[model samples]
Target: MSFIESHLGDARQRRRLITGIRESLRELGLHLSLLNRQVSSRLELKDIDVDCLDLIDRHGPISPSALARSAGLHPATLTGILDRLERGGWVARERDPSDRRAVLVQALRTRNSELYGLYAGMSTSMNQICDGYSDAELQVIADFLTRSAQAGRAAADDLTSG
Candidate 1:
């Protein structure tokens, strides 16, 4: 049985566990936001700028339209972020090889080491925490977190659309 399933003997216990999960997710989001803010400040960037750069790094050579969609910002706002990133040597705007008329934004390797260095401590801590979990347990945790992120994205979409 799963840890939660094994402990859920009654409806009250289940409700309490669910509430705990909800609260934990909220706390995690707040902590992550604060961590991003600290990292951005160290990089002399805004939190959203770092977030956009991360998206670009992960999805390059991606178009500005796609980056704007992923970042949930309007195209105009994304232009400003892209400009800053380009100026800081964090990213480059290049003509798409497949579509010469199109432009793609890609992360530059110049500051990538610095960015990774800032995240090394957190990466180490998370790896240590993951080491305690069995493969099956880790899979379940990953599935849950992935679903939670999807739910958050859907909820955000709903809010924005309405």
Candidate 2:
């Protein structure tokens, strides 16, 4: 092939690959939402409740206002979600020692193992998939996913702000 023709083919191939990646991401998001819904149903928890639990597990003991900001939930709605989580023994609201008048929400460690167990299958599957990639390839994939998530968050924030 001519040099210019070869370069044109490469450009077309790059566009196709980018399109495939975008579709794959969209499908992956739908599958993840399905998985989350299944796990939430198994635990007898609402989807939002499970989401709040994850945030708390990651960032607790966090104050309710901070949690609300992180979650993009209204404080009153978060209160109800917290109530359900507390009743389910998934989390607790306790006084912050550093500030007597404030309360912090924390995930209860007792139920953490159970939650982890529910996700163990996915972890194993992801590990098996990662086994096919070299470390450098895995790092690139991780970086891409992290950047994609950040971009999604930024886009969501823009939508909400407008």
- Cα RMSD to the true fold for all candidates: 3.9, 1.1
Give a tens-digit lDDT track for model 2, residues 1-162: 999999999999999999999999999999999999999998999999999999999998999999988788889999999999999999989999999999999999998887888899999999999999999999999999999999998887787677
TM-score of 1: 0.92
Rate residue 110 of model 1 by lDDT. Answer: 92
Q: How well does candidate 2 score on lDDT at residue 129? A: 99
Give stretches of model 2 more than 4 Å off.
Answer: none
Which lDDT values do the candidates have, in the order given? Answer: 0.92, 0.93
6-60, model 1: which lDDT tens digit per residue?
6666767889999999999999899889988989999999899999999988888
lDDT of 2 at 47: 92
Per-model TM-score versus the true fold: 0.92, 0.95
Task: Give the local distance difference test score of model 2.
Answer: 0.93
